[model samples]
Target: MLSLLATLWLAAAPTKDAEPPVPRPPPPECLSSQGRTVCGYQCRSTGTHADCARTPYGVCQVLTGRVHCWDPPRVVIHHPPRSSARPECKESRGNVACGYNCRLSQGEVACNSTPYGVCSTHFGRLVCWDPPESVIHQYGARTPQPRCLNASEAVACGYDCKAQRAEVQCASTPDGVCRLDNQRFTCFDPPSLLHCDHSAPPPAD
Candidate 1:
């Protein structure tokens, strides 16, 4: 009976529950060429294999053997044409004059209005000038002006002027005037002398 009791006691004793073994993570796979290690489902080298990262908008796939991040879908926007008043244009003397706002002269488009002043292609985009005065005054009498300069003198009335050691160089134009390099005096009409002292200083104020 004691033996039977001992067996019963052994059976009745409470058994401690055995703890479950912790899961071991798999070893990381190293990509020798890219020098990166990846584990599980992450990007791993399959020898020139391409992979992609998924996102809500789009998937970014590997390009040129490089891993790219998630990318969104591209959106294209269309713009309407710019609106402006139709230019009043006319052809005259092989040039197209487009109202007072712009003109097409010598195969170039020129606009005249700007915040600072009027603009013309002849002066380039950087050059601007005040608008011409609307009023005109007539003088009682006009005088004939000369166009030539003295020897060895430089004058730049309309264009560039340079004076060398023995000669004076002036730009030739039909409506050009003569003014010394010093800018002391301006000859609206051409001067009689084409040569003058280019080195002369400005006259007294």
Candidate 2:
């Protein structure tokens, strides 16, 4: 009877309590609309609360709580300046000439045309001439005067001629040989006697 009483007391004792189960989070949802698909949403705080949606190409931002998707901004390109449009020019003799054209301004003469000859300024004036005319135009006043010696037997002139008593002659052909023939002093050539006397005759007899 005492053993039976002990068994009843053991059965009456309370059992231990079971622990509670842990809570689980939900899976991410992939939403699809029209032809585009968005995976998840992102939040941005710039002094104000805004939300962004992630897409395959770019992102969609919410302005004033309004959602809008957009592509990246376009890139801009710039080009440098060109140098072939204008030509080089120069100024001279109070004249302005460029390329093949020349003009005068304010009492100044400019020449660029060279179809006849080379363009140049002479005595403050623009002139174009051939080889002979250019030489005369350039050194006409600077050239030395020629003196001729005349006598009964012979006559001589130019830098190479020498006068001795009654006869005057030139030593070398290059010195311009002048001979008094038939009362006329005929020079072979003034500077050089290698060529024929094609030059104009002297003024004095």
Candidate with the greatest TM-score versus the true structure: 1
Worst 10 residues of 2 by lDDT: 72-81
Top lDDT model: 2
lDDT of 2 by residue, 1-205 (tens): 9999999998998878786544332332454444454454332333333333332222344333334433211110011012111111345443334322233444654432221123334344443322222222233323222344444554543334555566665422333456656655455643321222222211110
lDDT of the structure predicted as candidate 1: 0.32
User: Global CA lDDT of candidate 2, please?
Assistant: 0.35
Off by over 4 Å in 1: 34-41, 45-65, 68-205
Error of 1 at 3 (Å): 4.8
Kindly list the per-residue Cα lDDT of model 1 for residues 1-205, writing each as its tens digit.
9999999999999999998555343332333434544322224344555343232222233333444333221110011012232223334344333222444555554432211123334222222232211100010011111122223333222223334454444433333444555634343423333322222222111
Off by over 4 Å in 2: 34-61, 64-205
